[model samples]
Target: MEIIAPGDKFFHDIPEKIINDTRYMSYFKDCIGVIDGTHVDARIPVEEQAAYIGRYHSLTQNVIAACDFNMCFTFVSPGWEGSAHAVRIFKHAVMDPKYNFPAPPPVDAGYPLQRGYLRPYLGTRYHIPDFRRGHINAE
Candidate 1:
């Protein structure tokens, strides 16, 4: 996991292109990467059915991954129960000293914006579907 899961060094070391990109420069000035949760289909024993059924109503494992602008996975936390909320998984992860997730930056209005992982401002549209639908094609 260390080979791909970046250490603290990566937080301060982002590419020039990503830093200069107008799309990210302002809001994401200190952000080194992005984090997202995903559900991976899995087939588990009947006894574990209740534990693995995800929001989509299927057997799965919930995974949270952090990646750089280049789309390379820098950190991947898998094996959480499918029903687990992404926030819960993240909270548990950072609390574990062994995992050593990056420390968050200074508090922002009582809400500590995660240090290296830049969460979108509340109410901003950041859904994947929004990006999938091209602006040129949207009515």
Candidate 2:
């Protein structure tokens, strides 16, 4: 709410702002986001501890997450068991059909699949922050 302000438009476009953000581009090249998990130190409810308890570490219930270049939550896997491995958690939580966020739209005739990734002749843009200068470039 604080960042979105009182009445910011939903479809605000700011692609030109990041077209050549060298630092942000260099830091995040070939990476859409960095993913990780951290334990939140809270004892599970006594009744729920049976499932939440980790076999090895046995002390924490974790909040798994994926953070983008701006630290926005692209994905979050909360209430997960304390012992879930990164890959297992990522595979299930991020791509599970239950998750609300939509996956990337499938490519059609214009962009052929290459090396198991989509390559397009052109692309659309979005209103994203420019971290190169540590400020928002709205235009």
Candidate 3:
């Protein structure tokens, strides 16, 4: 609660910084970042284990974040879980009037669904990847 500065509280220029930086994972262009679930040890009471025990072994929180090729975190949802999804946290962080990133084209649009872009299948929409790759005919 006390570590984050007011400006760094949520999404910001971090995503754009990752998109432009070429020093890290060069495979991506216009890609904002990637995230994965990891487990960590906890000291909480046994009653709390049910909520924390993640996919494989022990207690954990589902962390969803976007990091640049340089391993710098651009956007991060620190404490999240199976009850919620990564896309939901990212969307929540950005939609707050503070971030002001361009809202994605409405979900009803045709290109995303047809190309299998950010559908429920590809996982959450937080993947700031350069999805434009190999997308010449998508228009």
Candidate 4:
């Protein structure tokens, strides 16, 4: 835990990647890190395999992790069943004090908008190509 601490102290400064990139400097000036989840193969007893079998029909564990722009891991929450939804794991990480997830700044309104974090609305199509062409389709 000493090597991996999660708080503003460890991420107070804007990353160099964003600072150097004019396109993201102004927009993501305060951004700290990126969070995501993925499924990794897991080994378990035969009797417990069913619970781990996910969409890929293989035993796996869902892992939630976060990393700064420099590619350093800031937080990692692993061991969730592969069948578990990403939202379920993410909510637990945020609600559980033990995780000590860093809090982001506040936003006025939107889905998944918490005191310091925000996520894109689920089920909304967000193709960058479409956006680049100004053809965003309302969901």
Candidate 4 yields a Cα-based lDDT of 0.76
**lDDT per model, in order?**
0.71, 0.48, 0.46, 0.76
Flag regions of model 3 displaced more than 4 Å: 1-28, 82-88, 91-139
The ten-residue window of minimal lDDT in model 4 covers 107-116
TM per model? 0.72, 0.49, 0.43, 0.76
Scored by TM-score, the top model is 4
lDDT of 3 by residue, 1-139 (tens): 3232223333244454545667743543333334443334555567665766665556667665554445765555566553345456555655586644333323332222332114333433433344544343432
> What digit string (tens of lDDT, one per residue) describes model 2 on residues 33-52?
34456766557778767666
Query: Candidate 3 has which clashing residue pairs, if any?
Result: 24-69, 25-69, 31-129, 31-130, 32-128
Candidate number of the best lDDT: 4
A best-first ranking of the candidates according to their lDDT comes to 4, 1, 2, 3
Question: CA shift at 51, candidate 3, in angstroms?
Answer: 1.3
Q: For candidate 1, give the lDDT of residue 53.
A: 91
Candidate 1, residues 1-139: lDDT per residue as tens digits?
A: 5545655544666556667888967766666666788899888889878988998799989998877667777767888889988888887777797886655455353222454344556655576776777664333
Off by over 4 Å in 4: 1-3, 6-11, 109-111, 121-139
Model 1 scores a C-alpha lDDT of 0.71
After superposition on all CA atoms, how large is the RMSD of candidate 1? 4.5
